[model samples]
Target: MPRAWTLRSRPNGMPTADNFELRDAPVPRLEDGQVHVRNRWLSVDPYMRGRMNDVKSYVPPFQVGEPLEGGAVGEVVDSRAEGFAAGDLVLHMAGWRDEAVLPATALNKLPQLGVEPQAFLGNLGLTGGTAYFGLLDAAQARQGDIVFVSAAAGAVGSAVVQIAKAKGMTVIGSAGGPAKCDFVRSLGADAVIDYKAGPLVKSLAEAAPKGIDVYFDNVGGDHLDAALAHARKDARFAICGMIEGYNAAEPMCFRYIMRVIAMRIMLKGFIYTDYLPRMGEFFADMGALVASGQVKSRDTVVGGLENTPDAFLGLFTGANTGKMLVKL
Candidate 1:
């Protein structure tokens, strides 16, 4: 018998460990056109938090008693599908479990980028794609522009910093503490603000004396306000995630909401899947940057399938940095 996590109950505000239930899940018999997969790495992301609640959104909400699904990398143990074979490495959306029986159509073979298997869960997968499309497409960041990225030490944010620097942009990254700020500095940001040290707007102002031309927002709330306050006219803003208000009891009220009109800002919300049609372009460019050592990646790994709930909770508590994964 294998184990999988299920949504035990929807949370009122912040989710707790008790909200998830771990139970014995028997591996189902593989039907025709199906494969049996043993998950090697499981991804935990901020977006998954929203799925826990039973609400209508971009993606459907997770059912209260069903096995939770997410991105994962696994090796095919057995396959009834024609193209897939035993021992093939594949990426799928059958996570939150130790093992899975899935249709062949649901699996994607890992790219031959010459990187580690879990890199797909981070640098080359959702996180990386989110950063690339959000900054370059949604924000319309260009060379010589000053870019401000919130959650600079995070998976998507770190990628944005390196990508911006590689393209000859001035980057001002905001992270929580000294260690995170130092990590952003290593990513070649022109300025790294320790957001926890003082007022976010004040730090951002001091970092980029000139108003920023691009804002890559991850932790919205106050970070959104700060970017709005300091945006140069016609600045483009990519609203990727608002993690700050995700678990908060009250809704976020931007103090400088009026700046959007006054500064003529262009704020757009987008998801990485919006660029799936351009997948080949992303793979060619991002893969090269990664191989050239210009773009680096990191992960905070929690070992075991049983600890998946804790690993997911860690995202809100800042318990992990870079991409957070559960090594099963």
Candidate 2:
């Protein structure tokens, strides 16, 4: 029997360990067009927090008592589908479990990217894709632009820093501590703001001086407010994630909403799936950047399946510098 984490109850505010129940379950027999996968790597992201709640959003809510799901990389152990074989590596959304039985249509064969399979769960997967499409397509970041990225030491934000630098942009990243700020600077950010040091708006104003042309928002609330306050005319903003308010009991209020109109800022909320039709373009460009060493993958992996819940909770606590994963 394999073990999986089942949601025992919907979270009220921040999730607790008691919300999840680990249960041993039997692996289903592979039927025609089905494959059995032994998961190797599981992704823990902030967006998953939204799904845990019973709400109508871009994706459906996670049903209580069912296994919670997210991105995962695994190796096929049994296959009844054509073109898929035993021992083939694959990426799927049947995560939060040690083993999964999924339709072959739901699995993507792993690419030989000269990186570990888990990279598919991080820099080379949705994490990187979000940064790629959000910055280049949604935010429209360009050469000579001053770009501000919030939560710059996290998975998608770090990628944004590298991609912006690769495209000849001046990048400013905001992180919580000196070490994370240093990590952001090492990723080619022209300036790194320690958000914990003082007021974000003041720090960002000082770092940009001339105001930012583009803002890649990961942490909302104060970060968004700061970006709005220091935005250049015709600035573009890509609203990717708002981890700041994810666990909040009350709605987050903003004092700089009027700045968007006054500054003529263009703010857009986007999901990577919105640009799925153009994924080939993303693969070609991001793959080249990664292979050429202009873009790099960074990760913080927690070992074992039992730690997956803790790994997920850590996303809110700044426990990871890059992509956070559980090596199952």
Candidate 3:
């Protein structure tokens, strides 16, 4: 039997432990194409705040009384599939469950790449991949270009800062506090903006005396508007997750609609799943960076499956410094 966190109630604004109920159940049997896995680590991200709402999203909403699932790293305990074998380390989307039965297609074999396995859920997984494709493909950053990123101390933002620096771009980052600001600077960001200091527009203006050529937006709301104001002509804005407005009763409207057209910024909103096709290329490049020490990966890990709810809810309050995960 495995214990899992199931949805107890839909969250109103911010989710608490009350919204989740932990229950135990027998390990499921593997179907024809499925593999049984015992999860080692589970990830909790801010974008999941939107999934709590009973609204339509790129991914389906979490149903009441069902287990809440997300990215997880685990080991194959039983396999009914060809490519996988028992004891093989794998990464897949299995959520908060201590054990899961998933189709082989949803699982990827983890390389013995010397880095921490949690990096698969952060740096080399969806977070890092999102930053890689979003900045390079969507934002089209060029050498010497100036770039600004919101949620700059976070998993994905940290990856963006390093990738931009590696590409010879001047990167500026906006984070909530001085600690995170310094963290981004440590990741090679040319400038760091403390968004909690004052009006983001003013802070960004001071940080970026020259207009920014690319804006990788993760925390939307006023941050998006501020980036729009300081953008250069024909700048590219890769609109990723909007953690800021995820808990609000209503989604925040972008006040810089006119600026998008006026500045000729090519703004594109994307879900990380859209980049699944390029995961191979992402894994190859990002894996090389990790192996070579160009990119740094960090995880704030909580021990025990019982603490999964706290880890999930902590994302809303920016409690964790980097990627938030629970070790089962």
Candidate 4:
């Protein structure tokens, strides 16, 4: 029998294993216009945390006792649809399980990018897509710009660091500790701040004394404040993820709210799916970057579907340096 993980209950603060259930989920028979797949990889992302709450969001909340879903790469074992056959590789949203019978409309043949199957879950999928559109479109980062990135050693942030470097931007990245800071530096950041060591406001000022032309925010709170305080006139900011306050009980307060007015900064909040119509452009550009080796992936993989809950909890704890995945 195959298996699937379900949301047993909602969490009050940070989620625990008690909130998830791994159960026997035998694969079902394929209906017309559907394909049966054996999932090979499952993605765990920060955004999935918000979905766990039974609140209204851009996407529907995961129902209790139902299988949780995320990015997944799988192989087709059977198909009742055109353009799909056995042994075909596909990407779909039927994750948190080992096998699924899904509609053909919800499936896509993995682009012939020549990257590994798992890369689609990391650099080639949401992680890379988020960074690509967030930086270039939302932040309007240009060559010769000085940029600052929060959670610089993270999955999306790591890609942002490399992409900015490849495009000739002077980059500064902030990571929690020395090891992560070193990791960000190796991604070609001009300056790496060990945010755990000292004040970020001071760190940003020292790193880019000329002031930053762009800010890519992954962790909000102090990072947002620091970017606001350090932003030059007409600076552009892309609000990506605010992982710092995801599990917080109270609202976040920014200390440098006045900076936005003083410096005339433009803040743009975006979701990668906003560019779905523009995926051709994203693939054309990002695929070349991947081919050039300018953009690569660093992933922390947890093996087994039973460990999916642990892998998801790891996102809030900074347990992953890059992409966090469960190898199904």
- Please report, as a residue range, the 10-residue window in candidate 2 with the lowest summed lDDT: 111-120
**lDDT for each residue of candidate 4 in 128-246, tens digit (9 for 90 to 100):** 99999999999999999999999988899999999999999999999998899989988999999888888989988899899999999999999999999889999999999899888
Lowest summed lDDT across 10 adjacent residues in model 3 is found at 248-257
Better-scoring candidate (TM-score), 1 or 3: 1
List RMSD in Å for every model shown. Answer: 0.8, 0.9, 1.4, 0.9
Better of 3 and 4 by TM-score: 4
Ranking by TM-score: 1, 2, 4, 3
Cα lDDT, model 3, residue 268: 88
Which candidate number has the best lDDT?
1
Per-model TM against the reference? 0.99, 0.98, 0.96, 0.98
Off by over 4 Å in 2: none
Choose 1 or 3, whichever is better by lDDT: 1
Candidate 1: where are CA atoms >4 Å away?
A: none
Tell how far residue 327 is off in model 1, in angstroms: 0.7
Q: By summed lDDT, which 10 consecutive residues of candidate 1 come out lowest?
A: 313-322
lDDT against true structure, model 3? 0.88
Off by over 4 Å in 4: none
